[model samples]
Target: MGFRNLQTFLFFLLLMLLGLSAPLSAAEGKRLALVVGNSAYTATTPLANAAADARAFAAFLKENGFEVDSLINVDRAGFARGLSTFSKKIGPADTALFYFAGHGMQLKGENFLLGLDAELLSEFDVDAEAIALNSITGIMERKASLSLLFVDACRNNPIADRLNASVEGVTRGAALKWGWRR
Candidate 1:
C-alpha cells in the first residue's frame, strides 16, 4: 500500500509520541480535527486512495473522541469553508489537528496544498487556485493548547517539475527547495 493507506496509523503513532495515546475523556478538553483529501486534480493525475484515506482517518479520530470535519475532493472555496468551520470550533485548551492527503507543491518559497479542481497554467497560478499551508496553520495557531498538522503529499509533483523546468538556474533551485527539509 502507498502512504495514503498508512496515514491513519501514522497519525495514531504521532499521538503516541506526543503522549496523547492515553484516551482523553470528553470532560478533559476538546479534540478537533480537520481532515481533507484531494483526489481529483484538474491538471494532474488523480490519487487513487486519497478520499478513502481521509474518510478512514476521520472515522478513527472521531472514535477516539475528536470532533471531526471531513472533506473530500473539495475545490478552493470548499476548502476555505471547511477550514473556517474547523477554526470556529477551536476553543481554548482544544487540541487541533489538520490532515491533508494529496498533491502539494512549493512555489516561490511558499507551500500550497492542491484542491480537487486545482489547475496550473503556470507556477504563478498556485497562489490563486491552491490553498496556502499558512492559511491552515494560522487557524491552528490560535487559542489551542496543541496544534498538529499531518500532510501526506510528499510525492513528486508535476507542478513542481514544471516550475523547476521553466525557471532559471538559481531561482529554480531555490523555488524547488521546500525549506522545511533542510
Candidate 2:
C-alpha cells in the first residue's frame, strides 16, 4: 500500500478502535444507556436482585424514549463488550446513562464491581473479572451535556455470597442479607 493509503487505513482503524460509530442524531437528539447486572458469584452469595433491578431500570429508560442497551449477568468480557458497544452508540451532544446492580468493592485504591459469581479469594484476582468504574463513565463524559449514572451495586459486602445460612435457603445470597437489594 502507498503512504497515502496507509494513512487512510490507519485513520479509519483508529476510529474503529476508539469505538466511534454513527452519531445518534443528525437532527433530534437521542438517548442511550448501558445497563449492567453482575450477579454471578462463586465464593460468596450471588445477588438475586441484580436481574430485577436491571430489567426495571431498562424498562424505565425505554419508557423515557431512550435507547436502552443492556448486558445482564455480565462477567468481565461481557462488561468490556458492553462498554465498547455503548460508546459507539453515543456521541457529542447526545445523552447517555449507565446503571449497574450487583456487587461492588474497593480494592487497592480502586473500585471494582463484582460479578454475581465473582470469587475473590484475594484482591489480586479482582481486576481480571471486575473493571474500573471509570472505564464505563469516561465514555459518557465525552460531550454528553447530560450524563446519568445509577450504581445499585453498592449493596453491603460489595461482594455477594451464595445464599446465607441465616436465611435458611429462603434467600439465596449473603448480599441480600446485608440489606443490599432494590
Candidate 3:
C-alpha cells in the first residue's frame, strides 16, 4: 500500500484496538497518548509527511477520549524531556499510547528512533542522540496496564549504508528494526 494509505490504515487500526481495549479498563482507567513526529533531520533524508501524520493522529486520539501530548520536529533534548513528562503522567490504570513518525535505525541488536536534530556521525553517537525502542517500551511497561507503541520509520534507508562500511569490527547482519508497534 501507499505511504499515506498505510498511515491511514494504521491510525484506524489503533483506533479499533483502543476501542476493543477500552472496555477492559472501563471500570477504572484513563487513556493517554504521546504523539511525536520528526520530519526535519540534520543527518539523514528528510521525510515528506511525518509531521502531518503525527498531527492527524494526535487529533484522532484526542477525539477518541485520550489525553494527548503531541510534539513535532523534536530534538534530542526535547525528545527526552517529552518522554520524561509523559512517563510522569502515566498511572497504573492508564492505557498509555506512544506514536512516532520519523527516521529510525537498529544497531548492535538495539533499535533507535532518530530525533529531528540527530547527527549520526558515527554509530556510537546513536545511544547519545537517538531514542531507544526498548527505553520507550520499558517506561510504559512499568506503569500502564495496556501500552501501545507505534513507530512509522524507514525500513531501508541510505543511512543504513554506514553499517556496510568496513569499519573494523562492526557486524554485517545488523537488522534495522524501524517500526515499534506493540
By TM-score, the best candidate is: 3
Q: Which of 1 and 3 is ahead in TM-score?
A: 3
Off by over 4 Å in 1: 1-27, 168-182
**Cα lDDT of model 1 by residue, 1-182, tens digit:** 66555755766675784456676766557888999998877778788877878888888788776789999999888998998888988987788889988888766666788887777767667678888887777677765777878887746677667666875321212222223310
Candidate 2's residue-wise lDDT over 5-58, tens digit each? 744663465345323455444554567778887666555567766777687767
RMSD of each: 4.4, 15.7, 3.9
Q: Better model by TM-score, 2 or 3?
A: 3
The C-alpha local distance difference test score for the whole of candidate 3 amounts to 0.78
**Candidate 3 regions with alpha-carbon error over 4 angstroms:** 2-8, 20-27, 166-182
lDDT of each: 0.75, 0.62, 0.78
Ordering by lDDT: 3, 1, 2
lDDT of 2 at 47: 73
